[model samples]
Target: MQREDALRSIDVAVLAGGLGTRIRGVLGDTPKVLAPVAGRAFLAHLLDYLARHGAQRAVLCLGHLADRVTAWLAQGDSHHAIDVVCQVEPRPLGTAGALRFVRGELRTAHVLVVNGDTFLDADLRAFVASHRLSGAEASVLCVEVEDATRFGRVEIGADGRVLRFAEKSPGPGTINAGVYLFSAAFLDRVAASDAASLERDVLERLPPGMLHAVVTRARFVDIGTPESLAAAAEVIGEGTP
Candidate 1:
């Protein structure tokens, strides 16, 4: 699709509500999305990336210290067209539950979902296009990591459809890169009354041969811990993938 067409086609929903328990000490008092990396709020970098990739409208799912997140984003005027949606979970409602909270705000047939803590240099436009072309209900952006044991590994079929999703296993396989392209139909499947996890509740519940995984040639970084945060800062500073 053309750039303009793509820009008008997709809406982005960033999962920024996490408590960031792992990085709280280093980030003290600031929402994890506001943590500085390469001299800018991490959320700015994420929004900039999304805007460049043709995301016309973006929503930020916020929790814990949400006001700070809003204030920070408002100050920068980053991605001027972005829309911020605050999802305050009284109790921790796993990933899918958080998503379900904002189901009504999703305006597109497909939405691009990204974890606020992980940054991956994947071609999001192509990712969405691939999903549009494929008949799968959901497509996860995956990468081959050296330590698959730390993150859940997803197995894909010869045709690029997800066959199995293994959580933090010792063996080597493709790991979820914290990004996903999901059809609007997936929203209907989310239960409204209770907290649910995307991995454990939704993904695992999908019928066999439905969920697909796409391997991307992109650099992935998880900024949830001090060490990884430093690494992301270095990568951003050096301008290297």
Candidate 2:
């Protein structure tokens, strides 16, 4: 399929249910995804990004303070015209569990799973194309960083297959950008219950070469902490990706 058609055919699931423990001091009662960035709620920016890429449907997997997020969407603050659906998790499910919980709401063959607090200004079209070409069960967005201490490393082979997930260490290496593209069949294999982690339980245990890694030199940001949150506006507000 063409890039636009591919993007339109895929659904976006933003995992926004995490408790912002690290940034609680900075944004006391605010949900992490609602933290202000560039004069707009961070979730708004994420929806805008999806709209720009021709995504027509987005299923928000919310957990903590899901009502607030639903209320925000009800206010029609998002500039994009994309159809948005809110799926509130009954309890705190890890990233993998969240997807399994909302699998019925996903209406596409491929789903672009994105972390609510992280942003990667990479080429979505190319990423999708690579995933399609690789024929892997899932694809991960990887970026090279000077320091991989904050984020753990994602070891990938020369052929672009994810080899292993390494522990966080202070050194220059490639890291998972917290963005992923998974085929519906892949998600169907996950257990329907239990709070399983996306990193430890799912991706880490995937067979070697089963997962594709789409590495990019894109500008990336994870606003999980106060320091990164403070720098998000500057990086995300810069030029278009």
Candidate 3:
């Protein structure tokens, strides 16, 4: 399928429900996505990236400071005008739970998912096409970094099949890019939990071939900590990814 066609057909689901516990003390009352970066909300950058890739709609799963994110979207964005749907979580739901909450609203059999706090400038079309061609139910966008200490490593075979998830380490390794293309059936396997990690509970258990990986060299910046948030502008710069 054409890249433009793929974007229109697939819906985006962003996980922005976390409390931002690590940075909340510094950025009081602000949701992680609302964190200022390069003079604008970080989410604006993410939305722009999606818009550039031809994504037309999104489902934002929000909880902590949910109103803030929604209000930002409600004010109306003139730049990247994609249709937005906000799914407010009654309580904190883990990554997997939040995605599950929007099950019916996703509308598509598969949806592109990303972490609101992380900016992974990957090629959306290639990521989607990779999953389509691999015949896998799920695929994680992976990127190689000089140090995998920040995020645990994801071992992927030469065929792009996920082998195992390794613990954090100081040395260089491949890690999840915090982006994914997941099938509805694969997400349905998650039977509701107080808080479940999409990685630990689901993806990690899938058979080698059932889950795949798409590697990219796009810049990756996550604003999980105050330090990272401060450094984001330098990494992302003033241009769109």
Candidate 4:
């Protein structure tokens, strides 16, 4: 498929349901996605990025403070016309569970899932093409960091398939950038529980060859903590991926 067509074919899901415990002190009661960054809500930049890449639709899976996100969306804060929708998790469902909760709303064979609090400046078109070419059930975007101490490491085999994941340690290594393209079948395999973690419960259990790695040397930022959140404005400037 053509790059634009391929991008439009998949529904994008921004996983924004976490409790934001790490950054709670900095942002009181506000959902992490709604936290101010570079004078605008973080979700605004994310939706614009998707729209720039030709993503037609997006579902913001929200929890913790779903009303805050919904209220923000209601005020016409988003400038992009990317057909945004909100799915509030009845409770605190983990990443995988949150996706499962809104699986029926996603109207595509494949879904691009991203963390609302993180940004990776990589080509969405290229990632989609690579995922289709690999034929794996799922593909994860892996980026090399100078210090992978905070984020655990992702091991990829010579064949470009994920071998296994290693615990966080001090050193330069490739880590999961929290961006994923998953087939509908892959999302279906998540358990029916409300608290299953995407990393611990689903991803780590997958076989070596089942997950493909789309490695990129792009700028990656995780705004899950106060320090990282403060630095995000510089990493993800206006219109950055």
Candidate 5:
């Protein structure tokens, strides 16, 4: 699909509310999304990727040190037409809970949701198109990993529908790439509580055929740890696959 056409069909929601407790040793007092990678805030690189891939509007779910993020993004209109929504949780809300906070803002039949702390190279337009065509409640981006010990590993059927979500399983498996295309109907199922997890509560509870997975043939990195953050910087700096 042409970039312009894809841009018109989808909206973006970036989950940036995490406290980055795991990387605090390397990123003290800074939100994970603002950690420097390749001389720019990692969030900048994420926004650039989305914009290049035909994302016209973006909603950023902010929590920790959100004012700093807001001020920085507004410095020069660097985000183009992207919109930021502050979701100040009284206490930390898990993935799905943070999303539920802004459910009303994402008023689309399907919206693309991405983790702010990860860099993914999948063709987002193709992912969204596939989700729309498959008619599934949600479609997740999955990538094969040599070690799926630290992430949620997905088991998919021959038809590409997700069979199960195995969280942090050992051995070789396709892990969740932190990218997703969600149907609007699923958001209505999210309760107004602040302690829901997408992996444990939502995805796991879905029937076998309700969810789908798309395997990505591109490079991806989760930048939540110090070592991975360094690796992400190297990837961006070298511009190598």
Candidate 6:
């Protein structure tokens, strides 16, 4: 059942609404997701990747210079395959809040959530399949990294159910990869009026095992910093897998 439903039934929602304050000196007014990499907008790479995985549509949650993102999507950067939609937030709603803002457009009960600033080259089908098979409300992709200081650490049980999320600290552990598969029922748990953050207000606050994870040794990059943005070519350049 999951094999057939996984392809067309799932849509993607990318949360592209951050202030990019940390890299303001370098990016100026451009949103972090729009920062040029390999002579093309970073969102282009993300859209292409999603389309390649057979996702026919995507709804991008926009804020913090929403017009710029909407304009790019209008340019039809996503050729021939997937259709892209933009939902600009009235104000800066946090991560999960952005998703909540577009709750009406989720074409699938299980929608894929991706961070606009981070790209993880994981098998998208398998990730969604796990969520479908396990019958979990929410599932996140975690990447094993040498240092977890830059990101929050995720602890999961022997059965791959999430245990607890540790605050960002220096250590060797699995870090949240910023990609998730969420069921609509779980998204409904998010209050419409509340300013919600994916980590702080949702993931951390959820009961143990309510959220599950699939830890992978995948190639991941979060281009939120100047140093990492400079190195995007190596990871997202032409001929990349």
Candidate maximizing TM-score: 2
Q: How much is 78 displaced in model 1, in angstroms?
A: 2.0
Looking at model 4, report the run of 10 residues with the lowest lDDT sum.
Answer: 187-196
- How far is 158's C-alpha from truth in model 2 (Å)? 1.2
Off by over 4 Å in 4: 1-6, 191-195, 238-241
| TM-score, one value per model | 0.90, 0.96, 0.94, 0.95, 0.91, 0.93
TM-score result, candidate 3: 0.94
Q: Show the colliding residue pairs in model 1.
A: 162-212
For residues 1-241, what per-residue lDDT tens digits would candidate 5 score against the true structure?
7654565656788888888989999988888999998888988888777777767778888888887788778674354454555456666677888788778788777788898898876667677778878988788889887778888688899999989887686887798898888877766776454447877788788899788889985777888888888899876665422
Q: All models: lDDT?
A: 0.77, 0.88, 0.84, 0.87, 0.79, 0.83
Off-target runs (Cα >4 Å) in candidate 2 are 1-6, 191-195
User: For all candidates, what are the clash counts?
Assistant: 1, 0, 0, 0, 0, 0
Residue 227, model 2: lDDT of 95
**Residue 11 of model 1, lDDT score:** 72
Quote model 1's TM-score. Answer: 0.90
Tell me the lDDT of model 6 at 158. Answer: 91
Candidate 6 lDDT trough over 10 residues, lowest sum: 1-10
Q: Note the residue pairs that clash in candidate 6.
A: none
What is the C-alpha lDDT profile of model 2 across 97-209, one tens digit per residue?
99889999987888999999998888698999999999987999999888889998998999999889989899889999988999888878864545378878888988888
Query: Candidate 4's residue-wise lDDT over 12-118, tens digit each?
Result: 99999999999999999988999898999988888877877788999989989999888888888778778888899898878888888998888899999999988
| TM-score preference between candidates 1 and 6, better one | 6
| Clash pairs (backbone) in predicted model 4 | none
| Tens digit of per-residue lDDT, candidate 1, span 89-123 | 66666788778877788888888888988888766
List runs of model 3 lying over 4 Å from the truth: 1-6, 191-195
Where does model 5 exceed 4 Å of error? Answer: 77-81, 191-195, 238-241
Superposition TM-score, candidate 5 onto the true structure: 0.91
